[model samples]
Target chain A: MRSGSPVYRRGAALALLVVVLIALPSVVPAFFINFVMTQTLMLGLAAATIVFLAKYGGMVSLAQFLLFGVAGFMYGNAALEAGSRGLNLGWHPWAAVAFALAVTTAAAFLLGALASRTTGLYYLMLTLVYAVIGYFVFAQITEISGPSGITSIKRPELLAAPVSLYYTALGLSVLAYLGFRALGRTAFGLALQGMRDDPVRMASLGFNVPLHRTLAFTLGGFVAGLGGLVNVWWNGQIDPASIGIGPTLILLIIAVIGGVSYFEGAWLGAFVYVAMSTYLRDLPLIDRIGITEARFNTVIGAIVLLIMVLSPQGLAGIADRLRRRPTRPRRPAAGSADETEAAIRRAQLIDE
Target chain B: MTATRRRLPVLAAAAVAAAAAVWVLFLATDTPAGTVLDEPGAFVVTALDAVTFAGLLFVAASGFTLIFGLMRTVNMAHGSLFLLAAYVAVGVQQAMVGKTRNIDASEVGIADWLVPMLAGATAAAVVGTVIQQVFLQWNEGQELRQALITLAITVVLADQMLREFGGLAQRMVWPGAVTHFITIFGQRYATTRLFMLGVAVVIGVLLWLWLNRTRLGMVVRAGVDDRQMVRGLGINIRLVFAVVFFAGAFLAGVGGVLGASFAGAAPGTDGAWLLNSLVVVIIGGLGSIKGAAAGSLLYGTVVAFSPAYLPSQYSFYAIILTFGLLALVLAVRPYGLYGRPA
Candidate 1:
């Protein structure tokens, strides 16, 4: 019950955050809420899938974005009228959403089963190849996606209003954040972390390492699918460009910049990314430096490089360090040293 | 049991090869309806085309594999380096001729080709060295982090190249000597492609000699096998890494120049080349020069021949076939044909 307890402080901060998010539409301009905030939440949720794999499962997959795109494409294909381009089974909106999620989850499960055979850099490359292959397939499949991709899929009435959509995105984000946090403490989560540390040891302990990894990846895919569902609703379209290399890498950049070690970092990274992409072109300094709207990627690249060099753990890591600094004097130096040693060991294990 | 397990992959590989041969023979004959090949000469020409394209792929992928083998860094920016060189070569040729108009291949001399090749290779080597020293040097052994950093570099370099060189595709003016078609096996083939094939062969031979016949090559080999042991032997591993990076980037630059003369270079060429390099290295085995060659040949053949042989209705599936080859290879041999388990 102590006011100074870390749990109490965290709880209070989370409450304030919830209240602010709930009231954000009233305070902010409609454009900000609709364009920026909603996009941030959706992208954040997508990035959260990446964070979950990287942080807990020790797998940095480039295919999460592909899954997101798949979900969006599936929904668009299933819900849109047959008159529109691409396959349109003309299912109900809710059915389409469910179908999209289920397909995405299954795809992720299959991808994980295939990719889990390898670890570290091999896994990364395999997933990247998957994304690239997915992109090419989507681009060429005119029967399913058409040349330009499916478009004009109307949002369900429940989410037609901008405010409702915004709140839905926000609610989903919160649910995902809490879900990941809680999952991280579960037996399955602990086993995944164990596999991340030492698959051999986990295997000897009777854990089916590949199955655990695949299950985790499937969970991540479902979250990404949720994000994709909102994304299509917000944008009212799905195209090849949505899952192109640029967007694929951008999602990874978001996950890394936010801090892959923490769930909240996904949202934090997404907010920064959305803000910079939306406003960097308008900045006087950017204009002076000759960075046009098209060259915003350069700015983002520079920022990501800076983040990697200066704070490898990302903005969240930097925040954590700053928050812990004031309390460091009271804690034993051995504790910090031990933490660093553990981190080093974890990195080495991952490299193996 | 262990011996049986060890023999399994070889058996699988042989089976795959046999299946591929059967498929090729099936395509070569008139058994399939609407076959593109009316004569055996056409098939020979297509096969030659596939091999030449593979030559370009090997040139591009060799450096990537070399870099990956030594430093364990994926070097995603490798494709950007290729595109950069292509653009630079094009610029140099454009500037030297002092004309924006398309220069005929016959009008250009040795210097026209030589100068751009030198300039492009030099530029790419310098950039590669800078990347290794400035960005990658501080973060050694952290392969994933290094990969992300290179990815960032790719974004910046790709954007900058787009800014400097317009989005339109451009190609180099080939030297007059290699512009004509040469008769091979009673079929006309582009001499430029034959020249490319020759270049790839020469480069491969030189690389083989460098790796086997020289002390530096031995060090590189040892470093690839066990970097820590090499370092512990009092070798300056960082310098070796830098040299490998330079050579690898130089090879990519050469590939760019050669590729520009053949397929041309464009905005999205970086991603395409990157994908090609990835597939080649993955199939051939990462960090193995021989694997790259084998993988490139397989990949190039599939890409070139599939479209021609596939029915007109399903021609687009050729791309899928190329990727399917990768999937098949991965399923049989996870580390790749020539790759050792990390």
Candidate 2:
């Protein structure tokens, strides 16, 4: 139990995290528990959707926020009572949630199909255009979503308490993290990784590369929709401004800051972003510099730029470097490559 | 055989499109009485508006496509450069005339306009060069990194500009020489718009000549096609990259000045113009000047004409039509009309 094996260490870390989270509401102030912790969990979940796509699928998407917004919008429109400025379908809240997730998944699948035709930077541009177009469409279609958006989305009685909501968000985040971790070990996930490494080779190996990409994108959308569902319930409303380019970019910034390549980095980045945005302006140094809340974007931008320029791999990479610093470098023995090649050839011959 | 076969559907689509256009422009009578189709004068005005706006979009997009072609960097800050130039031009114009707003248009001379334009272009060019050299140069071949850096620069620039210039929409006073209205086809058109069109044509011709006849332009074209190969040929590609970036930024600045005079420059125009450039380049084909021109004209036409011809109740759907054009063009030619795969 006290061994220094990596698996044990990982298990211990996770258990400690669970214990800390479970005990947090009791120890921390209500404001911290409700606002900061809960908000961080929700944003972390949202950023996780981006991390999953980027890390596993080798696709950096700007449309995840749009999908999140879609789910919220669909849910709001479906569940709003009559006389509201939405579709006012008056469906049960649970049913609305299911419908919203379904819609988001389908929309993501379609977007993935269209966008998978292009790769790399083009993929980014296409998704960006889609998001921008969605923004305009939502803004212009005032009949469906009023200029101000839908409001008065009531949460279920079970999650009415701030602590319960916080715990729910925490549980969802943990599940999502574990699910993504497990997915990465699955055959489909490995194939997706291989496709990311070299799509042409994967396709030549008889893999349906586009289908896998689309499926991965759809899964990301569903997860993002879950985040959206919780976000709407917490905020009790959804608006165009919430899903605009500003929020879109902030999500990407959060993912990059946390470590786009690591699943855990999503929440880590979210925690930093939420805390900074909330408290940065109150800092004595920031106040003395005359940088008000209005100028917060500048600070954030500078930080992102610094992070990108210094370490493209993000905070996770920095931590990884720090943790591995004590390990001694091993020098390869001369002629080992020849022996390995001969062994591989012998194994291949035996298989044949 | 495949080329001809592909061309057939495209030809058929164009014919159907042309027929639809004719029906909308001349044959449609169910539209409201005051719409463009009902009035020939309105039709001419809208058409000219489309062309002038297309010229402006082309000017802004040309530089973007060039940089994208050579560097494979989207330069998301291109719109920021444009907006910055506009604000600078407005500020300089106001300072020269010693008035913040409502300066006498008669007193503004060519120097007043020309000086501000030059100042704006110079400022934008300097900023653009600095961004490229400082942030993007070291990360060559890392397209995503370059894009993200530019996006950060855009956010910072936008915030700073908003702080400095405030939220008011500002327009540069046009030169007295081109402030009058010119009549064409018996429809009065703003002379400033015609002047803009003329400037666009001049710039287009100059760029075409440079690209076809100059040594540096040849290298740029070659770089666009195969950058690694061009670098392997012992050419100083970094120098070319800097020169192209400078020119591109300079063009954006010019566009800023022109756009300010055409329509007022405001806080959110950066995002709007950025979207416009993206759509234009995507429609035309990435990295192709001719494609930019074609895409701009088509996009401009859709934007200008969609609202004019749509029913009053459906006017809001004009935006949908614009994006619909994008979707259609993308479906037909994924690389765009004149674009080739990268």
Task: Give the winner by lDDT.
Answer: 1
Query: Which portions of model 2 miss their true places by more than 4 Å?
Result: A1-4, A325-352, B1-38, B182-188
Root mean square deviation (Cα) for candidate 1: 4.1
lDDT by residue (tens digit), candidate 2, B1-342: 266765775786687588757867676565542434467777788888899999999999998998998888889899999999999999999999889988766879989998999899889999999999999999887777777789888889989999999999999988888889877667778888888998889889999998889999999999988999999999999999999999999889998998998898998788778888988998898899999999999999988887777776777677788777876686567668887654
Q: Which pairs clash in the backbone of model 1?
A: none
Clashes of each: 0, 0
Error of 2 at B150 (Å): 1.2
lDDT of 2 at A280: 82
Q: Model 1's CAPRI class?
A: acceptable
Best by DockQ: 1
lDDT agreement with native, every candidate: 0.84, 0.83
Worst lDDT window (10 residues) for model 2 chain A? Answer: A330-339
* Candidate 1: tens digits of C-alpha lDDT, residues B192-285: 8888899889999999999999999999999999999999999999899999999999998998998898889998788878888999998999
Q: What's the lDDT for residue B209 in model 2?
A: 90
